[model samples]
Target: MSIRILTAALFLAIMGLLVAQRFSLPPELTVRVAASLGEDAGYGFGEGLRRGSVVETGDGFLQLTIGVELENLDQAKTILWLAPNTRIELERLYEDEMTIRFTRGRIIASNETDVPLKIKTNYTSHLVLDDVASFVNYDFLETIHVIPLSGSVQVNAGSSESLLTPVPLAIHETDPVTFEKLEVNLEAGDAAEFYRWAGVLTGL
Candidate 1:
């Protein structure tokens, strides 16, 4: 009888240990560039702007958010990462270099300029960015609607938006942005076509 009791206790202890380890395990999130608005904006998956952390996950998706900026507005560039349920806000404008990255639960941004910058997010609706200068990157996010809160912001395709060559803009929708694939690149001159393709891919 004593032997059976000892065996039972050992089993319980092993089960407890297994449960603890499972709970302690960290979540997994991937970072990808979501969007950009300026003419001179630059982004890449390698080098100084390629770090990410896990934030949250549900239904085979993770969420993240980040904020970054350029230092000189005359030199340097920026990059970004994307994750599930990510939100970011831009606090400064016209920087020389700026980068934002998001992955799983981790979000990272680097600013070389002397001025201050910030990025905020709304996770309740998956991902919602309040500012256009602020960018987002994620594979799960299909459609991004730029709704102007005050004046108006341009959604540049390749780099910068000019008075003669206007940036493509889209109205916000009640449905979530969906995407078949997520790609990150510098704005060139095809803002309208790219956004139109994204809309079709995301079913928005």
Candidate 2:
């Protein structure tokens, strides 16, 4: 083969490898909480918490902040659930600092007690919300990690579908659901648009 042809072939092969690596790598989602008034300090990642460490907000509410690793703004919405009364503010981070604000929503807290929430993702699925009935809905299946900000959540895999179910609670709460598998390309910008469409369809 000619030197020019060989060089071009090598370049193409390198590009392919880079693209594959980008898609195969999983992103990390970090969650942080502030110390409550009169409290000594807050919990960090992998820290043990008491049975009832979560405290009620002074305004008759509880506040929890979750930092999710999303390919873009759209994917962020899939992993977040905002109650009507609960306020949600989206902030971008750069090297561990809030850099920009993307979106925010308010979720209404139904009961005073803590509610179970679930988030599920895998190599073949995007972020999925689970409730009691079954796999209610799913976005593109491209997520690599699942992070639960509050309560207990579980993820189950099956043929043609994946299940995300919230653990039962002592009080009345929302039911967990599962999601159907959908093919999505993680390396392209289209993934962001796909999640945007999902958010609209799910009213998120």
Give the poorly placed runs of model 1, Cα more than 4 Å off: 1-84, 87-96, 101-141, 159-204
lDDT of 2: 0.29
TM match of model 1 to true structure: 0.22
Which has the greatest lDDT?
Answer: 1
Candidate 1 lDDT by residue in tens digits, 60-158: 221112233233222322223222244333222333222222222223232333432233223212211222232333334433433222223333322
Q: TM per model? A: 0.22, 0.22
Instruction: Please list the residue runs of candidate 2 whose C-alpha ends up more than 4 Å from where it truly belongs after superposition.
Output: 1-8, 11-13, 16-30, 35-64, 67-156, 160-204
Question: Could you give me the TM-score of model 2 versus the true structure?
Answer: 0.22
Least well predicted 10-residue stretch by lDDT in candidate 1: 123-132
Cα error of candidate 2 at position 202, Å: 27
